[model samples]
Target chain A: MSRLNEAEIRRIAELAVKQLEGQATAANVEKVVHEAVQRMSGEGAATAARHERMKNVPPHNQAKGQRIILTAFGANSIGILAGLTSELAALKCDIVDLSQKIMQDFFTIMILVDAGNSDVAYEQIRERMARVGESFNLKVIVQHEDIFKTMHRV
Target chain B: MRIELPEILETIRMTEVEHFDIRTVTMGINLKDCISDSLPRLKNNIYEKLMRTAAEHVATAEKVEAQYGISIANKRISVTPVALVGDGYYAEDFVEIAEVLDKAADNLGVDYLGGFSALVQKGFSKGDLSLIRAIPEALTSTRHVCASVNVATTKAGINMDAVYLMGKIIKQTAEKSADNDGIGCAKLVVFANAPEDNPFIAGAFHGVSEPDVVVNVGISGPGVILRAVKEARNADFPTLADHIRRMAFKITRAGEFVGRKVAELQNIPYGIVDISLAPTPMPGDSIADILKAMGLQDVGAPGTTAALALLNDAVKRGGLMASSHVGGMSGAFIPVSEDQGMISAARAGHITLEKMEAMTSVCSVGIDMVAVPGDTSAESIAGLIADECAIGVSNSKTTAVRVIPVPGKTVGEEADYGGLLGIAPIMPLSKIDNSHFIHRGGRIPAPVKGINN
Candidate 1:
């Protein structure tokens, strides 16, 4: 679902209250507000609840494991993604996000994967990626997403 | 908290490409309870206690490293000062205990075992004198044992007698290990106002006030800090300082996490996290490089000390905000031999011994890992220690001297102390003799500024 901005939420709440006017009992107002929010959020309330539950459970036990950010840097070469993704797939890591670019003979790739459901441990997955990168003379680094959030964000 | 994609990539680059890692996880063990008048029983008790306390140290540190995907470089052990524990023992007896400590460290797969120390900041007890006398032999005979002596404090004046004694002892140690280019002296340190829970080698010792067992972690990442500074080249001073402070906070937070995890695994209390920007001999991991990246053409050039002052203060400010129990010498370490940039600067004659001493006044520890000529008088060495002690006592900061006098090596030569100790060029010393001043030694009275009461 797309993000709901503060302005949109406020506008929807105001509209709901205005529509109920004199008949706006507390329960009637609450129902109108909930329905407006659900419609504006582009998902049913039940689907939002399911998403919250998914977040509460440990990432490894979920269908998609914890998020890992893998970065590779080296000379521009073909078939790099083919090599890396095959190894990751064997380890049960699901690709959640990926970006690759080549500039002036330099190649760089960044992949965010969910390794929570992977049978391999974090260390093992890192080692496996390192081996694959080394075969193509590239440098691969894997780190947990939490480290970045803790360091970069408040 | 949701982690952004760019932040994750930045962390990966820092750890994998920039060589960011925890420097050490040192376990401090109190051996006061291991004291015994009988030499053999005392040795046995000390060994058994070390074995029991530090048995899981290496394995646990390794496990944690694998779990976190970060490297924990060294696992070491520090115990209560031997002078206090080996009371009434002869100098030779202290040597035996040093051997036992070395054996225990070997058994536990630890790289260094500190606390063969004497605290004679005021005056020498019989035990302190004995341990001082045994230092040269203790350091040369054992491979992993580290020795330190505290000779001055703000409350108590400098002990001139101990200073003189350490000078002679240092010379003896260098002579005893001449074949190794005075490597024994690399393992010894002389401190003024030394911290009790320092996790760095050559000065680490469990203070008399510390608990039975505690885990202290030393986190280091000169490369990481350098990268941050380089990225903010065009920014103003406040912005640059904020960048460094933020980086330091993250580094210290990681250190605290590792320290707490290791402490929990060992079932011991978590001790302080020493957020010293310790540098190795690696190409990109020098503290001097950080200063150079800050726009100094060379490390010892003008404004170098000012840059170091800013870096050191910013690190402490950042680290203090990151960890509740920050202690030890929590600033950037400027050991010459152990830093590649420093080695290059010294070799190019851009930096000098006096400049290093001046830098230490602002940095964490005093002149460290410096190599002087063999013919340099013992009196001069004592005078150097006295000068450094004066700085620590006056400023109420922790200062230490770990200069190695490479016997038969003169200026323009190099002494290769392999591995983490690195290599040093034999820097020239003053030709002026301070023998009369050193020989007429008496306590330099504590400064009036120390009387804040």
Candidate 2:
């Protein structure tokens, strides 16, 4: 959440204008500026650093960036994962980590999703996931993982 | 996952099953600058200030609730004590101010607005006297306005005159709202050593020293701790305390997260989190139930005070570590009507007024939500408040009285407030005359502890 300095912002704007000189339409200028800002804001760098720091951790536990934990539980049935994953994919969300367990007649699945890349709002994704759960006759809930980190971690 | 399955499931159980939720998100808006000699200009200033600052308070709270999957029970506002903002006004003018606050609260979509208050712990200002006289009328006329008067503190001792005046005020308020079982009294609190940044209603106020605007939160989770204590049934005292502390720590973290998110969204400064284990009328969500889980046969049993002392201490110790900015009444609240176990014990003749008084010495608040017969003399109510003030001043703790003298109700009947105010069975009080003592009202000198500095 660090803010860029004035000098840094001017540098990014200058680079964007110089790169888009030949094809400087409004849309193209906007696209280049957006990408440049995203790259300079540490979204790309922070993700790389986070992955480097989490190299020793298991893939299932290395949830970083803007991620959410989606939990689904109900009677054991087919296609729950398929239905949920398809909806997440259509929404442009990445399934960073997932685990499932079945006990007797009931199944519970927890999925760690990297939602940073999604163009859809988190609220809409939650609504879509809920619809997916309703279609599969399961109870699904999505919550930002920060709550767990705050409670369980130091 | 970095957070194991057990951790995730435990959180879900606490929120979905055990009723762990942020009890309130209160925005404290300082209204000192709105003061004026002209009442209309004053009213306009107060309304515009509150509406402009807190326009999105409820919506921001709801958005955070949705984001975290933990529901916030109440969205409220606490302004500077009205008496301070409208100092030169008379009683009727203060009542008009209350109406404006109520309108602002309704328009903002908040459930309650506090700080219809006066601080008279040492002595009354002209405004304080006026507001005290206006309480019964102001509370009866408004739906969302809550009032409090601080009559005592450790430093200044008990203002016996203010305490006696409050007793009469409580009676008048009861008479005014008699048809609703003296429900107006439920919205009024008399305090000793009241906190300035308290987010809980009926006693919350934006203290004079506070910033222009800030946000405070109250955390409530009796059910979560009750479950933890129940699971550790056979464990000894230290282990029991440990279990309570861990549960308190987790809930405090959640509470702070919610508070900070709401403040962040509104772009306001975040204040303290009052980590009080405030219970609702829900059956399992009772502090008395937690005591029973800690091996008490029932509330008001012989060791009840000891159990409560331990529970309150552990909650404070645990919560203090979880949040750096812990303030307000951060202990186990044992309000009778709002907690079902407390109501049950009172109805069974197990928990009495005397025992509750003793418990408040070791807890956060005092004499909260207890109902009495309509005929209880003002002197008797004053005596009860004086006793609580004595405990608070002597022990250096925050204490309060929210006693309801339910009009036309007797010991065998109950007064129903219906919502979070809950219901209260009429508890018997001593019939002995205390008029001679109460009428000698001037001041009880500050206790020895008050001179510690």
For model 1, how does the per-residue alpha-carbon lDDT over B85-145 read when each residue is reduced to its tens digit? 9979899999999999999999999999999999998999999999999999999899999
Candidate 2 C-alpha lDDT tens digits along B1-453: 377887888988998899999999999999998988788899999999989999999999998888778889999999999888888789999999999999999999999999999999999899999999999999999999999999999999999999999999999999999999999999999999999999998999999989999999999999999998988879999999999999999999999999999999889999999988999999889999999988888999999999999999989888998999999888789999999999999999999999999999999889999999999999999999999999999989899999999999989999988989998999999999989999997999999889996
Model 1: lDDT to the true structure:
0.89
What is residue B359's positional error in candidate 1, in angstroms?
Answer: 1.6
Q: Give each model's whole-structure lDDT.
A: 0.89, 0.92
Interface RMSD of candidate 1?
A: 2.5
Tens-digit per-residue lDDT, A24-123, candidate 1: 8889988998788867766546668998899878554575427887888899788899999999999988887788878798888888788877889887
TM-score of each: 0.84, 0.91
Which segments of model 2 are wrong by more than 4 Å? Answer: A1-65
Q: List the residue pairs that clash in candidate 1.
A: A65-A115, A65-A116, A65-A117, A66-A116
